[model samples]
Target: MSKADNMLSILWMLRSGKKMTAQQLADELEIHVRTVYRCIDSLCASGVPIIADSGPNGGFQILGTFADSPLMFDAEEQKALVHASVFAQEAGYPHTDALGRAVDKLKRYTNEKQLTQIERHSSGLSVLQPPIDPEQKGRLQCLEEAAGQRQTLRMVYGGSKGDPGTGSVREFDPYSIIHWKGQWYTTGYCHLRKDLRNFRVDRIVSLDVTDRRFERPENFSAKDVLLEQLLPDPAGDPSLVTVRIQAHDHVLNELKQHWLLGHALIERSPGEAVYRLDSTSLHSYVPYFLLPYGKALTIAEPESLVLRMAEVSRGIAEHYGSMLSGLPSE
Candidate 1:
């Protein structure tokens, strides 16, 4: 590795629960002890708080200040940080309560004029969708506590399959709360089912902290476990459905760029694209994809989808026709 890369690797190794001797670092980086010492000196000169001990058992360690110090960033860096903060808040990262504190610290370090600019820019930037309901306030608080203490929580969750008036209750041990696609979800070992499960925060009825505490597995990470459970099962058989659209370049560009369609674009032309979607539920997305194009687009798909779109178009046409006929003769 290069000198810079080796220095970063050294920092990462020391930051975690590991101690590295100069000899060890030399071996890892294929360098000599003198070279390692020179790298260490370079790091210390760069304001990286690396502490060295001169005993048989002591090695190199990262100082607490190194981990806790505020980072200096240029104007562009500041804007990027603010943008990420806004995005996190929009996505319901319960820990944003802590981000507010960090932002306050940053403001203190920045000059009055720079701080003013930052505030103005942040205020002007807005997320398209507002945050989800704050009803998960208590749930988020409980999850935070569980994560910090590595404790288990016995909570009552409402099932999604039930009616709003009649929700089924289940007890779960929350390992972590994750925000996916603007929705908050908690994944953990389900006490009632004797296995892992994920529950949406909005669907949870109540939360209860239990006296029972369990040891977190040595290899367990809430984020990793949640992602594993949330991924769609790939073992299912794939189905191919063809969908055709005749949208203008603007719409086609959006479709290519943002890829509003969940499936892959199988084919495209000057003003049209054909998608080979894996889902059988094509009806759900047809209306949305067609709405932007208005009368300029047509759906030529699995005969059923074509019929459904025709039916919707006929309804719209009849409604417009009735409205025009109802207008006073002029």
Candidate 2:
């Protein structure tokens, strides 16, 4: 038998509580006693609790609990582990190959009955996720490796609105991998900007881990920082103000689920809600957001916002209306 196969056979025998010596194991497996000793040593090195004794009657025996460690993961545990992998896979987990091998080992060790239960659980449950770009997976992995080692990364990062092909180069100390609203972002200290920034993983055109290393800020959370950057934290700043709106209860419920509006939201009633936001978000994003709701939502305050929405609607109308100005009446 091959070395691995021979080692596995030795382990199985020891697990049976037979207390067999090296010569006995060697005789049963058709291998030399020295080979049996080597196999036991290999198993011990790999964390198997193989107890060796020197007395005339002593023989190698596996610790009772260690011999049966596979049973610790009951059927439910196995199913849960496998099901959790679905979420990771959907999110384009970077080390998918390693994850797959780990899961395969779980399945390989299961009994027929447990395997049937695992299949039953897996077949009955599923998750819906947006498809991720293939290239983002590699970027996520590289960023993870660099962050784990406190290494800096150099890359061409597309600015929030720039095309990836034309992105400028930057080097940053990666801190964490954050998942928000179906998108992945790497939050870190940007060398070019000399400030903390979040770069969309998909918008990374090229990336390389450098030998350079840096310290992560004390008590930092990438998700918290990303949220503060994306939405409402600016609302609390002295420069921002509150805008209140009223809508049907059902419509308001749907609106509150929005990533931007949800965080900005300050107070709400059955028929009204108030959101705190900077002028930029109010004028730039709210108009388009409310346009989809038609008359379902009313801007109860901030007369400026009402007027701004009107201006936006008018501009859009004229922009599209010009296309039909020369067309024949229909």
Judging by lDDT against the true structure, name the best candidate: 2
- For model 1, residues 178-278, the per-residue Cα lDDT tens digits are 77666778777787788877787887766667777766556767666765554332224256466677778677777765333533576789988877654
**Highest TM-score against the true fold, candidate:** 2
- Cα lDDT computed for each candidate against the true fold: 0.69, 0.83
Regions of model 1 farther than 4 Å from truth: 1-79, 111-117, 120-124, 158-165, 188-198, 212-236, 256-260, 266-270, 278-280, 315-330
TM-score of each: 0.58, 0.75
How far out, in Å, is residue 70 in model 2? 5.6
Tell me the lDDT of candidate 2: 0.83
Candidate 2 clash pair list: none
Give me candidate 2's TM-score against the actual structure.
Answer: 0.75
lDDT of 2 by residue, 1-330 (tens): 799988987876676566889998898889999999888889889988999887899899888787656634766788899898877877777887899887875655454556678888877777788877777888898899999999999989775434655779989899999877788999999999999999889888888888899999999988888977886573457777778999999998988899878887888888998888788878998789889897988998799899999999899999989988978997
Worst 10 residues of 1 by lDDT: 228-237
